[model samples]
Target: MYLRKMLFILLTFVSAVSLAACSDDENTTAATPTAKANVKVVHASQDAPGVDLLVDNTVAGTNLTFPNNTGYLQVNAGTRNVKVNVSGTSTTVIQANLNLMENKFYSVFAVNQASAIEPLVLEDNLTNPASGKAHVRFIHLSPNAPTVNITLTDGTIVFGNVAFKGSVDFTPLDAGTYNLQVRDAATNSTVVLEHS
Candidate 1:
């Protein structure tokens, strides 16, 4: 009888332990889900002052200066629109689709997409702007130059430089509308040869 009682006690203890373990598992909570990825974008171009940088119809910044007519964009892993304009020429309009990703960087360059050719070289008064303004194609031909700088009438200055030539060509500005002061940091000279 005593042996039977001891066996019953052992079985009871095992069952209780199992029940407790099961209860603990049922009471425990699960972990939380992970968050989505973050994104960012940047834009710069030759027509820094004249070009408008837009992402998804949102105006990021405008009238800014850049070299290589290039820029950057950060967005979700999806499609985006990058529009370019030189103002008046028949080629004032240029556009591209940007593929963005979470926590990633995007590089964009304004070049012709039709035949793998370079972007149009914007020259004010040469073809006349659609806005009826003369423009400037601030070009930095010296790729070996350390930096290319631009100064506006308002005392605002912008700087950039490319290590290679044939990289980018085009800056659109209103002729006789704005004052532009450009210089090459390497040669300590101006890049925009002719200013109107």
Candidate 2:
């Protein structure tokens, strides 16, 4: 009889522990329904002045200049209002509503001339590349520059004729040092060069 009682107590303890663990797991799952999203603001307009970025009317980034970006801003996943204003002025340069998904990444591009600025939102590809490979992407932000080809010093064209405010998809290459050059597509004149 004593042995049976002890067995009953052990079974009850096991059941209680199991129930507690299950309840805790359920609570954890419920608390994590949505994840945060990351957004980057890029200033691509060649002549536009530095600007301030706002999220829900709050200043998220300030003094973002041409051909640059505010690396990444973490925000809750939902519909959001994004606004860009010229620095130290009330002049609103760009305003738009963005629906951001959980755990996603985005880039907001402010492009065109200062008088006629435009906004472009692009979803970033966040997929991981294969092992032993490096991934690279390019954004063409120069307003006056013509369509350009990104080439290696060896004369191999990696990306061709990317227009102003355009971008090239990420391409994977083996790890190595490279000399890259950007040339005007029409005239083949080198505009930018870098070694990496």
Candidate 3:
């Protein structure tokens, strides 16, 4: 009788230990890390009011006016629902389904005018520039602006023949301040915009 009781208790303890080990394995599998991506938002709509950026109905940016931008935010890799709404309101002015890949970076630009607002999604290349250099790119966000050449004040064209809503790849430049001008591409002499 004593031997049988000892044997029963040993079997029960062994069964409980086995179950606990199996549970730990299941928990480890469920805790696998999720793939992720990085994204940034740029408010470039020329005529739209200050806006908010939403990802899957969650506000990612708020009260972003023209030419403002939000820093990169990490998100799960997959198709994400992106939306832009007027500041302080739930009225969605633009929405898009964006496919984001793991370990990549993206930029979402809210562009055009209030009457024709849209999203311009661009993949960002984050390759490091060479020493003493920086990366530069040109994006034409003016809704009604003409095809233009981006140039230095000295008339050296940095980006040529960029039309409205056009964009250019990143170029390496020596780290320094630059005086830039947007000139008509046809004539390349009429400065429509200037920046330093």
Candidate 4:
């Protein structure tokens, strides 16, 4: 009879503990939804002056010079107006209406010479590469540059037939230092640029 009573008490305790666990789970709140996107801006216009980048009329970057970039910044996702104005001035040089979606990444580049500067928007894929690999991408921002191939110094082509303003998608490469060069597509022998 004593054993029966002890078994009954143990069963009751187990039941109460299970119920409390379930109750705690039911009271827990879920994470709130986010309505934001990440944006980065690059100044690729060789002849353009230092500039300010504005999103929805609010300055996001000030005095961004040629070849400089404003790294990823989070902003409200929706129809947003982006503008570039000469630094310390009210004169707007480039503007665009960007329809950004939530949870995505975007890059905006100011390209071409100062006289004809324009914005180039690109969706960015930031997925991680495989283990022991790295991601690389190429963008041809030189306005007058020709179709070209990117190659290793040993002459293996990594990217081919990219023209002016063209961009190569992110590709995985084994992580290591590489000596690379840009060669004309037509002959694949004339070196345009070289980097180590």
Best TM-score among the predictions, by candidate number: 4
lDDT of 3 at 123: 88
The sequence of per-residue lDDT tens digits that candidate 1 reaches over residues 75-109 is 44566665654432223345666554444443343
Cand. 2 TM to true fold: 0.77
**Which ten residues in a row are the worst by lDDT in model 2?**
5-14
lDDT of each: 0.37, 0.74, 0.75, 0.76
**Stretch of 10 with least lDDT, candidate 4:** 5-14
Q: Residue-wise lDDT of candidate 3 within 1-196, one digit each (tens)?
A: 1111100000000111233333343534456689999998887775679998898999888999877778889988999998899999999999999999998989888877789988888887777777777777777777666687878888888888987778887777776677677777887765454443
- Please report the candidate that would top lDDT against the real structure: 4
lDDT assessment of candidate 2: 0.74
Q: Which stretches of candidate 3 lie over 4 Å from their true place?
A: 1-30, 192-196
RMSD (CA, angstroms), candidate 4: 20.3
Clashing pairs in 2: none
| Candidate that beats the other on lDDT, 1 or 2, i.e. the better one | 2
TM-score for candidate 1, residues paired by index: 0.31
lDDT leaderboard ranking: 4, 3, 2, 1
lDDT of 1 at 177: 39
List the candidates' TM-scores in order.
0.31, 0.77, 0.79, 0.81
Q: What is the lDDT of residue 28 in candidate 4?
A: 70
Off by over 4 Å in 2: 1-35
**What is the descending TM-score order?**
4, 3, 2, 1
Q: How many backbone clashes does candidate 1 have?
A: 13
- 174 Cα displacement, candidate 1 (Å): 45
